[model samples]
Target: MKTYYIKNALRVLLGLFMTVAGIGHLTFQREEFLAQVPRWLPTDPAFMDFVVLSSGIVEITLGLLMIILVKHQAKVGLALAVFYILIFPGNISQYVNEIDAFGLDTDRKRLIRLFFQPVLILWALWSTGGWKYFLSKVKK
Candidate 1:
């Protein structure tokens, strides 16, 4: 029971974090996030803006679902983990291109930041039992 509560708390915290990040994507930190967009992508500013905005919307939705859809948390967690995976390239781009944003000013810092992506993915899965859910499905 204690473990369950702890997981719930962590899930809620992750949701809040993602919500704020999504807001940052849409608002205050928009420019900072723009730096993370892979340079290989089209340079058209409008298209880039669309990518950021759409991803922000997806983040917001996933965050809210992670919080409110407790009964479906496993699915929500899976979705959020997938989302984290999807955005991993952005983090990679930030590191590879040596683009500074969110205080990852140095190459080492950006490189270290890359490792946290897997942690976030694990956190999402573990907090909502998505890891077990997925494993069970795979075993069947």
Candidate 2:
């Protein structure tokens, strides 16, 4: 019971973090986020802005749904995990291209941050019982 509550609290915290991150993508930190957009993508300013804006919207929606869709959390968590996977290339690009953003100004720091992506994936799954949900589906 206590563990469940802890997970719930962590889930909510993650939701809040996502919400704020989305807002940053669209607003004050827009330029910073632009740095993380893969350089291999079109460098056209408008297109890059569009990518950031659209992702921000998705993040906001997912964050809200994560908080409100408690009964469907496993599904939501799975979706969030997939979203993280989809965006992982941006992190990889940052590392490979040696771009600096969000205070990760060094190769070592950026490389270390890359490893945290898996942790986020695991967090999304574990906090919402998504691991069990995935396993149950897979075994069928």
Candidate 3:
């Protein structure tokens, strides 16, 4: 019972984090987000802005769903994990290109930041029971 409460608390925290990040993408941190966009992507500023805007919308939606969809938490968790995976390339690009943003100015800092992505993935899965749900299916 205690564990359940802990997980719920963590999930709520993650939801809040996502919500803030989404707002940042849409507002004050827009340029910072653009810095993370893979350089290989088209350099047109308008297109890049579009990508940021659309992704921010998705992030806000997912964050709200994660908080409000208790009965569907596992599904939302899975989708959030997938979303993390999809956005991972931007992290990779940031590290590889040494694009500084959000205080990840040094190579060591950028490398360290890379490790947090997996933690976020695991957090999304574990906090919402997605890991247990997957294991149960695998055993069948």
Candidate 4:
């Protein structure tokens, strides 16, 4: 079905996006990711680096699972959604602290960026039929 193809395409695209972002976390854009880390977290630079590195690894793994685990799409979707939720505070801190990264030099831009996380969560759930699956389970 056309809808199924579209959902698959979106999932693949999201996976690619997350994979590239994870690589950035580990490599060229490390400092930018560091900026996104919440100030409330420990200020030890080494600890921040470790956090970034570990989160990057998680992102890469989740991205790959989203793409390759078709039969477990709903489960993958739920996991990705939870991952998005887990990282949301970083986005919130970025906006609240007025720390600019990834060329989001303006507060308005950063605030707008904050909204994308929820969209990603919803996208994961919808694309993989996770929401429908959850609803079905609830009805049982």
Off by over 4 Å in 4: none
Tell me each candidate's TM-score.
Answer: 0.97, 0.97, 0.95, 0.95
The lDDT, on a scale of 0 to 1, for candidate 3 is 0.91
Ten contiguous residues with the weakest lDDT in model 3? 129-138
- Write the residue-wise lDDT of candidate 3 on 1-140 in tens digits: 99999999998888888988999999999999998888889989999899888889889988988899999999888889999999998999999999999999999999999899999999999999888887887899
Model 4 pairs whose backbones collide: none
Better of 1 and 3 by TM-score: 1
Model 3 TM-score?
0.95
Output the number of the lDDT-best candidate.
1
Clashing pairs in 1: none
Model 2 C-alpha lDDT per residue in residues 87-117, reported as the tens digit of each score: 9999999999999999999999999999999
Error of 2 at 114 (Å): 0.3
In angstroms, give how far residue 135 of model 3 lies from its true place: 3.9
Tens digits of per-residue lDDT for model 1 on 12-122? Answer: 999999999899899998998898888889979998888888898998999999999999999999999999998899899998889999999999999999999999999
Where is model 1 poorest over a 10-residue stretch in terms of lDDT?
34-43
Q: How far off is residue 68 in model 2, in Å?
A: 0.9
lDDT of each: 0.93, 0.92, 0.91, 0.90
